[model samples]
Target chain A: MKSILTEQQLEITIKRLAHQVLENHVDLTNTVLIGLQPRGVFLSDQLVDEIKKETSTEKIQYGKLDITFYRDDIRKELHIANRTDIPFSIEGKNVVLIDDVLYTGRTIRAALDALLDFGRPEKVELCVLIDRRFSRQLPIHPDYTGKSIDAIVSQKVKVFWKNRDGKDEVCLVND
Target chain B: MSLSTRHLLGIKDLTVDDISLILETAEQFKEVLQRPVKKVPSLRDVTIVNLFYENSTRTRFSFELAEKRLSADTINFAVSGSSAAKGETLLDTVRNILSMKVDMVVMRHSASGAPHFLAQHIPAAIINAGDGVNEHPTQGLLDAFSMRKKLGKLEGLKVAIIGDIMHSRVAMSNIYLLNKMGAKVTVCGPPTLIPKYIRESFGVEVNYNLKETLEWCDVANVLRIQLERQNQVLFSSLREYNIAYGVKRKLLDNLNKEIVVMHPGPINRGVELDSDVADSKQSIILQQVENGVAVRMAVLYLLSGRNPGNN
Candidate 1:
């Protein structure tokens, strides 16, 4: 296992990502942040917290999306679904999708399909903590990224959160 | 996580974990129904057939809608117009359908253990819609879902299944499920309508007085009088039964506290449940019907994901 980002680095990277998101959608009037379910929620939750702390605004239109039903590979395996709480409307707003890691791009593909079901958004942007380079199976790229790493197909990228994993770090593990 | 069993033949065959998994999954599907596009592609690659050897309204439509919502191709077969009317056997009918590459079978029949019989012979997963007076597993599941949604939890909750218990597959399923989930259940109705060994066999309280049962429970699930299923005279008449055991508004008004009312529909209003009580705010009868689709969706989705070798 190789540590890509330590505790201190992960914290700083999250703060930077929050600031980047704020800089793009100032005051976040019509902008919404959606976190993908199961694993990506940790990163999105942290990012939403940081954004709230910086802006002192608690009215951020944040939501959680579960794309288990929209996956193209559902026939191969069955995935248990998680709660999807989008209390606000995302009809014509700019949406930022947050996740922990970006690889293969299939989850993002499914996420996009799931998002369109809510309503058509003005624009949709992707944000991730780590971008695994040279391993995407689909044509998807992150608009805001914390760290970019190059890893082989066999290596697994795992992001650990303090809330869920008892630590904040990113590691690339080899089987 | 997948269910422990390959087929949903009865609530008697499910563990607490399996029931929890199904109810939890149904909660998610209920949210999907509120969205603009109330459909998912989870079972797009699969095909299912609904074989109803008995007459049905809500169960048939609920299963069909659940299948369509999951994007599964479905074929509806009623015994009235089907080849089964031409003196075809049950196994022969299923075998012919299986040859068409169907993945799952949703079946209802007047014969007890019909789905169980089909499951033994076919490679496809079987979901017993309702098998004679045996078990309607999906109805049992949706009832649990509605109760949990309303009452918050099932543990230690007092539920009374009132009406014709002897002929209700819903009653059997509910009793098994409620018992497994740590809920207290009582079968309340005319003494003749309820079985003799119910208390000893299922460990549920048996009540002959309707008003006493209503006052002692948190939820009252009144069942319709299955007149067609009764072979002998269980009661004097419909009027006599209503006066003795019908859930009337006057009786509900006399209760010290409010209790939820539920009915598996095609309600013989004024017989088992009065129209006013059935249409009251406490009645989750319609919500039970609405939740039917989601609960069925959860069942189909979970069973379809079973390992091929597992079945």
Candidate 2:
């Protein structure tokens, strides 16, 4: 196992990602943040907290989306669904789709399909804590990334959250 | 997680975990139903067939809507106009349909254990819509879903299954499910309508008094009088039965506390459930119909997830 980002580094990277999101959106009046369900929620939750702390505002439009129903590979295996609580409308607003890791890009593909069902957004952006470069199966690229790493297909990149995993770190594990 | 059994022949065959998983999955589908699109691509690649050897309205349409909402291709078969009327056997009918590459079968038959019989011979996963007076597993599931959604829990909840228990597949399924989920159940109706060994066999309370039953339960699942299924005169007449056992507004109003009212529908208003009580705020009859679609969707989706080769 190779450690990519330690606990302190993960905190700094999250703060940097929050600032980058705020810099792009300015006041975030027409923007919304959506965390992908199951694993991606940890990153998005912390990112939203950091954004709130920086802006000194608790009115950030945020929600969670579960894309299990929109996956193209559903026939291959069964996936249990999670709660989807996108309470606010995303119509004509800039939406940021957040997740923990980006690889193969199939999840992002399914997420995009799931998002269009809510309402047509003005634009959709991708934000991730770790981006596994050179391994995407689709043309999806992240607008804000905490770290970019190059790994082979067999290697797995996992992001550990303090709230769930008892630590905040990113690691590359070889089988 | 996946269901323990591939075929939903009856609620008697399900574990509490299976019931909970299905209801939990149904909760997700219920949210999907509230969305703008109200459809999903989870079962787009699968095809299902609804074989109704018996007549139906809610179960048939609920299963059809559930299949369509999941983007599944469905074929509806009614015994009246089908080859069955031309003296075809059940096995031959299903075999012919299987040749069309169908993945699942939702069947309602007048013969008990019909779906179980089909499951033994067919490669397709079978969901028993209602088999004789045996079990309507989906209706049982939706009832539990509606109860939990309203009362917020199932364990230790007092539920009374009122009216025609001897001929009610819904009651059988509900009793099996409620017992497995740790809920308290009582079969309430006329003495001749409820089965004799029900109290001993299913470990449920049996009541002959309608008003007493209503006051002692948290939810009352009143069933329609299956007059067609009854060969002998179980009661003097419809009016006599209504006066003795019908869930009238006057009786419900006399209860010390409000209790949820549910019916498996096609309600014989004034005979089993009065129209005023059926339309009352405490009645989740319409929400039961709405949840029926989601519950059936969960069943179909989960059963379809099993290995296709095995199914």
Candidate 3:
């Protein structure tokens, strides 16, 4: 396993992404944050916390979306459902869809499908902690990328959260 | 992954993994119910026919709605209006339906094992909606799903199923399913309502006393006494049943533990359970209704195979 981002590197990358988001949306008035289920949700929680610490933004609309049903590979295998506590509506909101890593862009595509079921958002942007280059099956691209990596076809990128995994790091391992 | 059988005939036929698979798939679709646009284009090319020989409007409608949400074209067979009313056999009616290229048949018949018979004869997938005191597999699944959701796990959880044990498909299916999921089950009611072989055949304990049964269980799925199904005197009177078997506040408090109250509804409120207990915090009766759609969707989604048109 090749370590990509250490604890300090992860912190710096997250802070940079948070600053970039704040710079783009000053008030975040119509902007709501949604994270893909399970793994992506950790990044969302950290991002929201970092954003709140840096800025005086209160009442930030944050939700966790489960894209299990919308996934293309659902029929191919079994997928356990995750928590989907998106209470507020994303209708007419500038939605920021967050995930830990962008690999084949299939998960983002599924998230997009799941999001459209909620409501027609004004605009939807993708944000990721790591973006794998030239490995996308779809034309989707992340608007806010933290650390872009060029991993081989047979390699897998695994993101480990500090709270859940007892460390904050990213690894690229050969399959 | 596909189920071992093409048709879901009964809970007796499902393994614990099969039960878990259906519940997990149902949970995935539960999010769809919360969405504003409650339609998914998953089964656009497939067609399902709801063939009900008996009047189960509630269960039938739930399956129909689930099919619609999955974008599957549905043909709600009016069994009474069709040639089946003119004394057509179940086999002939379904054969005619299958000739129309129907991909799946969700059947609710008055006779036991009607879906099983159709399943053997027909090529299309068969889901036993309700088969005359035999099994309502989806209802059993939804109840177990709700149980797992509330109690966190199914294994080693004690569940007490009370009232109308003799004629309830719900009771039989729940007993088979909860047992398969490694939960202890007790069927309690009048001596006449409790079948003798249920204890010996299934190994689920039989209880005649309500208070003792409530004390023993972590969950009590109080079932509606089907008056329509009752042709003989099973009990002395409704008041006696209420007094002896009905789940109310006093009996619930005797348990002194968090016991979930559940019902397969169209409830005989005062007969099987009181209003206070039915509407209480311990009850997950309403959540069962919401889960019915999701469970049915999962059953449909998994059994129908991947939609070739989805890609």
Candidate 4:
């Protein structure tokens, strides 16, 4: 039932994950991070900013992806998310796929399919802001996880960013 | 960070947020045009292929300016000069462009679903400039963007699109997009010119009487009366059609002054609309042309995700 991660804790976790990412991925030059649209995009930017501040390296290329079309949820309708604005070519770049939370993993699968259409990335590592230990449909896990919360399928965790919301926090909502 | 794509093909494919992003981006681009430099580094290395099978000047030029201002490399490919007239298939020409390592392709073809067709196969982002009288998605976006700028809010706004309903792809795309964004849409044209089951398909009202439709909305989008489709559709004569549907001085007098007048050009000055009305203060025909570039820029930036020259 406790899916919420405090603001201070989330910050510390992201910092730690950023450090770990820098440590494992030595060459920051070829590394680029792509955030899944909405929340992941903002999180990817944050991670890039934090990492840049820590390492004092050139800014990592950030890409946003809208995986709505790749989603298996809604039936094929005329109106669906079709335009994915990824300006930079992903070819040969070491990509760090960032998302707000790792839930059923269907989104990650969709993201992967969407990414491939752009071009073949040299390597792609999953980075989740929060990894909720639940029923995952696919074999996907975060290479870099900000925090982990164990919760039932019915429970939900919402990520609040500082830009939109004055504070950054994850709350447990009863769905 | 940098955008990854360069073109937008259709509105059906664009999300509500994406639509908003393009609108917002267009607003930003519009500000730059007012300045002296009137250029940006967003598309320096990006090559935008304007592969138009159909003949268009305003739309084509709008896209060209949008790309050049963004610092993108713009290639104007027409059927006359391009290999397509030399018996090349649509897919082959697109493949050739792809092979050339071009970043994006903005296509205006006579085939209704050409953009959709290219969107499926091409690696470069496909932008629907206008496709086979099926969907002029960019025009719809520009029109909606213009309306939103003028009206401030789109929700619950009554908008009636009149003239050449069946042949006007502008009307078709606008109906879908405008209705989706919370505007009530009514399509009006001569009964013969209006396609069968248009109302039932899109959950919108259909009216043949232009006077009634004009009275029902805050904005009346007048489509061009095609000279070619006149006799074929058997709409009697231009003079008769003008008397009924034209936004003439008399009709304009009857409507509210605040009720905006619009047309997707090149207009048939006195056929679907009077010259005075077309050139009036309320007409957004020129603004629509200007907004076309910004909308196209936004589309190009969003689709390819590549920054042209600068961020």
Q: Over the stretch B1-311, how does candidate 1's per-residue lDDT look in tens digits?
A: 68999999999999999999999999999999988889988888888999999989999999999999999999989998888889999999999998898899999999999899888999899999999999999999999999999999999999999999999999999999999999999999888888999999999999898888988999999999999999999999999999999999999999999999999989997898899999999899999999999999999999994565532
| CAPRI level of candidate 1 | medium
Better of 2 and 4 by lDDT: 2
Every candidate's chain B TM-score: 0.98, 0.98, 0.96, 0.93
Which run of 10 residues does model 2 chain A get worst, by summed lDDT? A51-60
Cα shift from native, residue A76, model 1 (Å): 1.6
Docking quality band of candidate 4, CAPRI definitions: incorrect
Report how far residue A27 has shifted in candidate 4, in Å: 49
Tell how far residue A155 is off in model 1, in angstroms: 1.9
Candidate 1 accuracy as TM-score: 0.98
- The residue-by-residue lDDT of candidate 2 on B18-57, one tens digit each, is 9999999999999999888899988888899999999999
Candidate 4: where are CA atoms >4 Å away?
A1-175, B1-7, B229-231, B305-311
Stretches of model 2 off by over 4 angstroms after superposition: A56-58, B308-311
The local distance difference test score of each candidate is: 0.93, 0.94, 0.88, 0.78
lDDT of 3 by residue, A14-106 (tens): 998888988887788789999889899999999999989876666588999987666777555646667687889898999999999998999
Q: Point out the higher-scoring one by lDDT: 3 or 4.
A: 3
Each model's DockQ? 0.66, 0.68, 0.36, 0.02
Displacement of residue B60 (Cα, Å) in model 1 is 0.8
Q: Which candidate number has the best DockQ?
A: 2
* Residue-level error in angstroms, candidate 2, position A83: 0.5
True contacts kept of each: 0.75, 0.69, 0.47, 0.00
lDDT per residue for candidate 4 within A111-137, as digits (tens), equals 887677667889999999888876688
DockQ for the candidate 4 complex?
0.02
* lDDT of candidate 3 over B36-74, digit per residue (tens): 988876677679999888887569889999999988999
Cα displacement (angstroms), candidate 3, residue B210, comes to: 2.7
Q: For candidate 4, write residues B1-311 as lDDT tens digits.
A: 22322445556665666667677767756654654346655455567788888889998998899888777887778899767878999999888887787878888988888888887786677788888668888899899999999999778989999988888888878987887788999888888878899878888889888888888889999999766544464578889988888888778787765689888899988899999888889788889888888787766656643333321
